[model samples]
Target: MRSLRLGMTAVLVGVASACSALGGDDTDPAADLAADLAAALSEHSLGDVPLGDEAQRTAFAELVAPLDEVPVVVDVVDVLEVEEEGRAEATLAWRWEVSDAAAWEYETTVALTQGGDGSTWVVAWSPDDLAPGLAEGETVGLRTLTPQRGDITGDGGAVLVTERPVLRYGLDKTKVEGTQVARSARRIARILDVDAAAYAERAEAMGAEAFVEAVVLREDDALDVLPAFRRVPGALAVRDTLPLAPTREFAATLLGRVGPATAEVVEESGGRIVAGDEVGLSGLQARYDEQLRGSPGTAVVARGADDVLRTLFEVPATDGADLVTTLSPDLQQRAEDALATLGAGAPAAALVAIRPSDGAVLATANGEGAAGADLAATGQYAPGSTFKVVSSLALLRSGLAVDDVVSCPATTVVDGRSFKNYDDYPSSALGDIPFVQAIAQSCNTALITNADRLDPSDLSAAAAALGLGVDHDLGFGVYFGQVPPAETETGAAADLIGQGTVLASPFAMATVASSVVEGRTVLPVLLPDHEVQQVAPQVPLTGREAGTLRGLMRAVVTTGSGRFLLDVPGEIGAKTGTAEYGEPGAAGDLPTHAWMIATRGDLAVAVFVETGVSGSQTAGPVLEAFLR
Candidate 1:
């Protein structure tokens, strides 16, 4: 035996990114903090080589006590290498770990030659460190690692995200000098949707020496989108998972994003991170980061500065758990389409559809033109006339008749505050409009007027019981709309018009529709089969009051603003609204919020088109189209 040693680096990971979520940035502007940390560790850590005394460990902590509170502190364990004998090379492992999270970990092995003891040290990419642990017999630790990922799934049990095999394509900075890497960065950027010019600048900034990760993709992955860079010189593409999700967006907000696992982060997890590890970023994945991120196995083999692969002791890889969602693809598409058409070209919009009879959101989607992903569920906006249903419920409960006269007005004062009808339409119609007509047409004056006479606290208590401005852990954001101020006339006016603080999501309006259909209050749920996973605290109105509100809502379809949808097949009830958003640069920038809430075929929904020109012209047709 020639006592042979070769430096071979192998990231033994053959799995796709599952729970991996991308952090804001890999190169954050925290270099000074890292430098100070590295300096403190150098001055105090490893003071006495082998820690034979119990006091030494505690003393080391004391030296870096100032830095410990800051969260990033570490010691230089060892500069590990693989020196081969007659073969001119050796095999070694470079282990890395993160001191935070204290629950996750990963490792990498390399085969290289002895460039003498301190000739050239291999500096890893971002988050990877150069420290090596004391080499125990037959076991050499390189870097610490961790991978954060969680379960994922689709409404119909379609597997969209899961752990699978992967092939890594890494670049050794030692072998390829400076310009030798520009082409790599350019090629990788084009492939990953990154800016090539920016990557080039960074590559140039790294100067002549330093390892940089240009790209990471599954093995044998085809460059389906960027065909120009396929099989280019100095390019490497290995075997990675066929982790496939049919839709590009794929409820991106809820399912989350994935990226590589870091060895430095694993020590914090008390786990291992192989190259195969990928963590989750948001929604379901983040909520279950621990359970979704499984412990990884290791194929420990030490290597030198060269680059070689060797096998020492190996632990078989482990797979992460699977997740299932309550998404209904077909319904979601239809709902999204309906909203887009109704928005009148507004940049942002959303639709939340649920089976009113139950509460399962059949399909939830944001329109293509929709601006900002506050998630329609979490977004707060003026409910406009759609909120009249609530005011009507209050009035009916307060012993008001459908035909009672309150004298409609173009502009009226309520509790000292002035309220105007839509576009300041005349107030004379008030005397004959009656309650049912006022509700059918979603009369703002009627609502504000009646709201004025009622107790503000009563509206608040009633709205609370109806699940307004409430939050729930449905794996999605849901904002409960605010009720108007009853104590003050201004609040009363704002409340009656669904303006002022009466902001809500499409989910809330749909709940109103559900309450009407189900004859009681209900929260919008995303559980399977529209099942009620959890009932948000709500105030259930009397069955009689609910029935009255339903009748008025039906009149909205029969002869009111939503009459255009009267021919909508099945027992469908709907209300149309054109809510005025504030002026430019003001909160809720859009000028009008066209709204239509309707139910048919077991579904209740709220459609919103921010700044839509007209409720009947815009949102009305959309509702009809969605149901058809």
Candidate 2:
């Protein structure tokens, strides 16, 4: 009986201790209510909390609805106080991710109250609980502030691309009656020379207050159509400025274009870019876009029903830095002018000029024939006899001298392939001639006959020494020419004259001319500050060898096909090339690509025409005009 009484007493004591641990009587109702409110706010849900009625809960949800577009996080920093009068205050920390680079953060005091029963807690609903100073009927939104785009500068700090005045022509629907909207749009499109029916349909489909843009033209071009545009009832012209070069075609392919960000750009930006933001689309503009497009500003604002806005937070925009290049404005204009002489409907052509002394790319010009292609820097073609410069170096390395007697037969045969000189090859210079005369005359058979003096790899090695075959990333699109080893005897014969398996761009040929003048491998540079890496050739070119090559090139201008450049002012060294391509034409002969490389004073220039009679006939005049 004693043991049973002791066990019963012990069981009663354990029950009392468990009840106390569970806060049976010492629990603070106000503190519990405050903690529940904090949890509800953090979860952005009030369904599990006893702090608000159904109507109050709905109001709280509506107040935070604008935050759905952004990421929001909330935490209770402190439960400041709980009063006997059923009132309390709690500090809530709010964070909103506005963009990838920006966030909005602040602390706001939330008021809590106990119901009249003193057992239930309710939140005092107010817009300030969501954001400080927010009022009823006001909504928060994010606004982007565009930063000024940077300019592209050339040699001597000359602005190559800057914001210039332009006129935006469009059809304003509200200015005209609904029946006349399409007709007015058609008239404006006709005047602008755009697709009239398409533009008319677009204008009809837009909202009543919409302005359907027709075209953006330079200020000077707008003058011719302004009088006609004003006659239309809804036609309007808005003045604006955009980054532009001196003319529409001024280095258009290399400089690239800028316009509103596309969906792909927005998606790829990871929140850094948004719709309606201007961005680079190609070439140097796209290559270095981030460096040229600075950080944009952002503003978090609350807009009221009356349309008034109050800023909650703001970040200032940072302007972009200028991009400086090695181009000379005057020289670039000259090269373009020279190519312009080809007139309309001419074959594709390209010209590239480099300063031999420093390897600065002075000009890169593509003729109208290129049709917006970057042929000067990236077009690959058979270099033709201009490759003789590289082949000549290989032969020179094999102990052949400029004065060495070599046979320049009218035609030569190699491994069942019959090779012949150009049809216009001079009869007097045929038969036995000095090696220098063979180069000056561009004799195909002469170089093919001497192919026995070199191994297959010798050509590529020589090409590398002259900056022809090796590739380098100079911060832009460029092909530095290629000289692969010939696989057969016929291929070797053709490779000796730059025909079989050899390819080069005008940019590469210009580097070849530059190396000859600079007395070493000259790698062209477009961006002055970009780090240029050099790939050492297996056999580096020596100053003495370059000097000898220069003299031989000069002989061409004096006595060979390049005599066309003789009248130009300064002493010039030049080589002319005519490479046959494709199947035989109706004339029983293949089409030829014209090529010419020349060095005068500090400038080394290369000109190429896709289909021409000969290098001296087609490319020589262009080179002379640029030199003059």
Candidate 3:
């Protein structure tokens, strides 16, 4: 009986010890409640803590979820019994980092309730506990404020590209019947003058509710097309503004175009742009996109269930700067008109004009079928006999006089490769002739036979002096020609004739002609202050070299291939070129690229036609029109 009594005593003592460890009057219930709440808010997880009933806990967690996402730090200051039994009051300091623009801090009192066991306690939760003065049914949200994009201007402060009203018309696949998606896309494509079949396929591939854009037209241009879209089922149109030029084809290639930023562009932008922002696609618009796109502002806002919006903090957006270019609209229009006169179905062509004194690109235009391709400024083509100008400089520097005797043969072979004159080469002038006459006649044999007299560096250096085969940062898209090494005798012969990897763009050629007229390297400038300043030529043309080249070019106009320009006013000098390209033998019989370079008093121009038989017959007329 004594042993059993002792066992019972020990069992009671063990139970008391466990209970004291789990809960005791010495514990600060309010402090424990504050620690639990802070831990729960930090992890955004409620783990078996009873703020109220199960339903109440869920409701409280949902209410505080958004607030928990914000950076928060909490500290409990003190706790004291209130006037009511089993109820206590506690004070806490709540620190909230709202955003870069604002921060919030306040002291708030929370109501604590003791559990039925008296040792356990929990705060009577309310939205106000999270943030002082925050009421029920209110939530925080972040809003982005977009800024206005800037304008791209040209010379004389002419706005080249700006935010213009446009109608974005396309097919909404989800809104239309499954079978009607293709039909609707086709109709929209036809109305917009795009490829119908391609658009039909694109529409069928999109999501059911996706909007497949067909075309975006200027407000004025869309007026006539909008009436037709109404007849097509499932057709939808959104009126919006985009960066656009005066017309669809105005310097389309050099100025570029703007559209919804692509996934690639957005990814490249880091975090500056979201999914739906507009960005430049090509040309100058793309090159200076960041500068043209201004900084966006941010706003911290609060909203209620009734849809009332209250701004807690706001930052104003900054507008972008205006980009100015060195373009003359009048001359640009005239150049386009001259290209249009080439008639439809004409191969892609381009005309570039520059001011010889300042290297200002006055006018640039691509012909029919060349829009958006930048053929004038970026197209690389063989300069053909026009390259003889560079060869003339090299020969003059190599101790050959303008009146030096050079052989003009019907056919000359270099390294076992036979080179021939043009099919219409005057047979009477086939014998030995003055170097000047050979240049005027464009005698390929004369230059080919003399190729051994020059080295690859000799040609490269002279061409560099004329701005060919040299690199320049013009602030926009430009290919300043390329001169590959002519390691072999035959390669050197072809290089003398501007072939075998001698590539030149019309912009580069025009710069070369300008250099001769100015007696120095002409640096082309488009955008002021945005691009690298033009540097003086590393090896400028000497007065004697320029004078010699001028005399040779004038000979062509007075007695050679460019004789047609003799009657044109202010016609000082000119050179015509016809380059053979493609596979050798029968493939070479295809029409050659016609080219002409000319200089008037203050203007120097280069004209190119993709497939013309004769430079004098094809490019000469375009030059004449430009000069007139």
Top-scoring candidate (lDDT) = 2
Give the local distance difference test score of model 3. 0.79
Model 1 residue 360 distance off true place after TM-score fit, in angstroms: 1.8
lDDT by residue for model 1 (1-628), tens: 1112222322221112222111113321112222333444445343333222445445445433432322223422222222222111111222222233231223322222212342222222111122233121222222222332334665567555665555444333454555767776777677666788887667656745454556655433534533554454444445555233435344555555566556554555564444535665455565555557755544444443344434433444445656656567676666656655644555566777877665666766666565437455776788888877777776766778998876577777765767666653434445557788887766777676666467766666566555565556665566767774555567767876677777888778887777777776666666443233555444565677767777888898887777777666787788877787777655544578888888775678787776677666666777777888
Clash list (residue pairs), candidate 2: none
Q: Tell me the TM-score of model 2.
A: 0.89
TM-score between model 3 and native: 0.79
lDDT of 2 by residue, 1-628 (tens): 2123223311111221223211236564544555676667766656467655467687777766655677777776654333234455556788877766778899886666668776666666567677888887787767877888899999889999889999989998889977799889889999999999999989998998998999999999889999999999999999988888888777888998887789999999997788988888877888878878888987888999989989988777787888899888899888889998888899999999999898999999999999889999999999999999999999999999999999998888998889998888999999999999999999898899999999989999999999998999999999997899999999999998989999999999999999999889998889988997899898999999999889889999999989888888999999999998989999798999999999998999999999999999999889988999
> For every candidate structure, what is the RMSD over all alpha carbons to the true structure, in angstroms?
15.3, 8.2, 9.1
RMSD from true fold, candidate 3 = 9.1
Cα distance off (Å), candidate 3, residue 603: 3.1
Off by over 4 Å in 1: 1-151, 154-193, 202-224, 235-239, 242-245, 261-276, 298-318, 339-345, 368-372, 415-417, 424-431, 527-539, 584-590
* Candidate 2: C-alpha lDDT: 0.85
